[model samples]
Target: MAKIVVLGAGLGGVIAAFEIRKSVRPEDDVTVINENAFYQFVPSNPWVLVGWRDREDIIVDLIKPMKKRHIELVVGKAERVEPDQKRVRLTDGREIGYDYLVIATGPELAFNEIEGLGPKGFTQSVCHIDHAVQAHTAFEAFCQDPGPVIVGAVQGASCFGPAYETLMIIETELRRRRIRDRVPMTYVTSEPYIGHLGLDGVGDTKSLLESELRERHIKWITNARVIRAAPGMMTVEELAEDGSVKQLHELPMKFSMMLPAFRGVDAVRDIEGLSNPRGFILTDKHQRNPKFPEIFGIGVCIAIPPIGKTPVPVGVPKTGFMIESMVTATAENLGQILRGEAPSHEATWNAICLADFGDKGVAFVAQPQIPPRNVNWSGSGGWVHTAKVGFEKYFIGKVKAGKSETFYENAVLGLIKTKKIKAH
Candidate 1:
């Protein structure tokens, strides 16, 4: 029986551990190590910042569920990964050996890259629960004295959905409180267009997003690179039509939140041949490290290059569905390994995004996420919100129950069954 070690305990990590549990033999051991006892629903962090959800509502104890799944759980931060030794060193100086390792630590938020843009300043982020709490306090203060607001992801940033989600939720909350008119909001993004979304503009997304922003009176500045940020002001450079010289603009704001470029976690950063310079691990089509077949990575931590270059900097986005597909493929391959067989499969990027637009929302599904793709489609409606909420509930329940594969299979089978029924 093989021993498997998974790191992080985030959505990706927990999902991998649970899937391993479902597939590996009883004698095999699967262990998860994380610094925190509870798993944070990262997507709902925006709601926490907007006061739509509380800190407690998004935090769940991972111990009980992990125990039920018969997986060992270690609550400690990983210090280093000695890949050659097949061991992981903990912050407390303990080391554990494993036959297989899965890196799912997710991306590191590089707030320090931008001057005066972290918790030390007046600006706040919704990247983590703590950040969300601080943002909530900042938003409350803004309510007392409404002013200009800046919200968007920084240059080289990939995760644009959260930035957009946070902006709209803030607008929705401000409108609900009757203070929206008192606040001036602007979206500053590195994308060449407003809706590049790291996939080179998903199917008319640019047009739809531009129209939505105009209709909502939310000003946007694209192809702009943020140089630095202070409490109430930010310096940005607007790309010229020729993309040669940059024209600078200084914008003032009372509140701001910007998603920074992502990098891999510190523990695995220094390991030779283990990660890219940006700290993301390099994995094969099967999600296994090229040098070590037993080692794998998934989610934002894996190094996948940007789709294309735009006037403004944009990194590829690993959306929910995309992340889910990675997890599914990884789990299936690991299962095959446990069964003494070769893994033969590849997972493609199929994005299904539900972008909330205040009271209503926009939904889109683009298979092979990049532009000029097959089966690109979208629709706008209020029911998308309900569907999003339902998906959130379903996702949280799956994590809590430690039924990763079962949940995923049921979801896919249901989709297929629905398609068959419609055909009939």
Candidate 2:
């Protein structure tokens, strides 16, 4: 019997385990290794920072769900992945061998790359649950004494939605507290434009997001490179098209949250032919590592080159639907291999997002995530905020149920898609 191991229990890992269980042979052993015992809905982090969500609201204890599904849960931080040995070594000196391994460890936040960036430094971060909690405390303190606020993604950062989400959500909250006028906000991003979003601005995101920023009286600095972030001050350099510094600005702020660059986690990085220079797993379209077919990768941990050239480096975002597609494809391919058949499944890799602005939001879907494609669409309204909240509930429920989206739920998603298009 093949011992299948799934590493990391984030969005990609958890669903992968549940779906793999159904696809693989009954006798095949399915185990999951994660650094934490509970799963935090990362998309809801911005809401948490404003006290809209408690730690318990989005955190799902995986022990119960994994047990219910009969999937072994190994709770430990992975030290390294010995691909040659087909085993993963944990920090506690324990090791787990496997016939097949799915690496979904996600990216390691590269806060140290920039001077005085991150929760430990001058800026706050919402990349993790704990970080969001800390950021909330900072937010509360800032609200009591409002001043200039800096919120955006730094250079080389992949995920840009949360940067925008956190920016607007905090803006919405500050207004709610009647302290908005007392605070000046600036959005500093590596993207060439306000809505570039790494995919080069899906549909009319450029116009929509720009218009929204204008209506809300929020100033933005695209192609911004954060050189240093000292307490209550950030040194920002705006880049020209030729990659030269056009201007430098010292922005004063009482609160800041800059999304840091991301690299591959320590566990699966730096092996010969196993990963790229950045430590991201090198995988074929099938989501299987070329050097080690038994080793598959999904989510932000996988290597995807930047979409196009920009003044500053901006990595592509692996959105929820895109990662979900990767998970489904990998599981199906693994099932084929186990059944002694050639795999013939490919993920759609559609990029979809619901960028919530607290009370209202923007929603978009890119057919293939990579540009110049069909079905590039985006829209905005209060409906998106409601949709995002509904999705949070639905997804967490699925995780608790130890299942993927059910057939009925899938139909509901289809209906939602129809409604979104109509609203658009």
Candidate 3:
């Protein structure tokens, strides 16, 4: 009997455990290890910050789902990974062994890399559900006395969609409150351009986003490195194409939400040959670690190199579609291994994103998730906001039902049909 373990219970981990449970034989054991007992829909975090969603609205108690699926849940913090021993050491003096392991522990937010940044400091964040709640509190206070607002991602940050979503969402809220004019908003990003999105401009995102910001009277600074974040003030250094300091700007802001860079979690990071220098898991096409074939990795914790050299470091985003592909591929490959057959599945790594503003949003698809793709498409309208709302419900329901349906694939089919109409 194979003992399969999935570490972390985020989007990738939860879905991986469910999918693998379906794929494996009845006698094969499946278990999930997560630091949290509940699952929060991360994509809804921006809405939470704007008071559109409460904590309970997005959270699902994992206990019920795991029990229903018959998948064991080990709710505890992991201290370290002993790859050689094929075991995981818990913080509370316990070791869990596994025949095959899937590591989906998402990125460790690198907020400390900047001075006076993150929730513990001056700025707010929507990376986690708790952070989103705190950001909502700060948003309410900022609305009372509106001033300049800064929203964007810092250097080495991979996930750019949330930053953009939060930026536009905040703008939409400020306008709804009729205090938009009282607050000057600026988008500061490490991307070379307004809509680079760490994928080098999917379709016409540069034009789409730039036009949106202009229409909303929002300012922007690309290739920006936020050096420090003091209360009501931000120190930013704009970088030249040659990576030199071009200009230093002291941007004033009463409220801010800056997306920090991501690195692998402490448990698996520093494991010899398991993680890269930046602590992201090293995996091949099958999402299987080359040095340790029994271990697979998916989602934000996996290492995906930047598309190309940029003025400032901008890591590639592992979008929902891409992570789903990884989970499917990993499950298929593990099933093959359990059956005494060689694994052959490989994730497509496609990128499909829905970046919703309050009333409108943008949707983009990158076939291969890299540059020079077959189906590089992006579109925007009020429909995207509706679509995103549907997506949030669909995904959270899947978590409750223990289903790993190809959510993005199904959504993208309709998007492609729409793209075809536009093409004609």
Task: Look at candidate 1 and tell me the lDDT of residue 206.
Answer: 82
In the range 45-134, model 1's lDDT, one tens digit per residue, is: 888887888998888899999999999999998888889999999989999899999999988888888787766764678888999999
Which TM-score value belongs to model 3? 0.98
Most lDDT-accurate candidate: 3
lDDT of 3 by residue, 269-294 (tens): 78779999889999998899999999
Clashes in candidate 3: how many? 0
Better of 1 and 2 by TM-score: 2
How should the candidates be ordered by TM-score, best one leading?
3, 2, 1
- lDDT by residue (262-370, candidate 2, tens digit) is 9998887789888999999999989999899999999999999998789999999998888888889999999999999987888887877889999999988777789
Report model 1's TM-score to 2 decimal places: 0.94
The candidate, 1 or 3, that scores higher on TM-score is 3
Best by TM-score: 3
TM-score of each: 0.94, 0.97, 0.98
lDDT of 1 at 153: 89
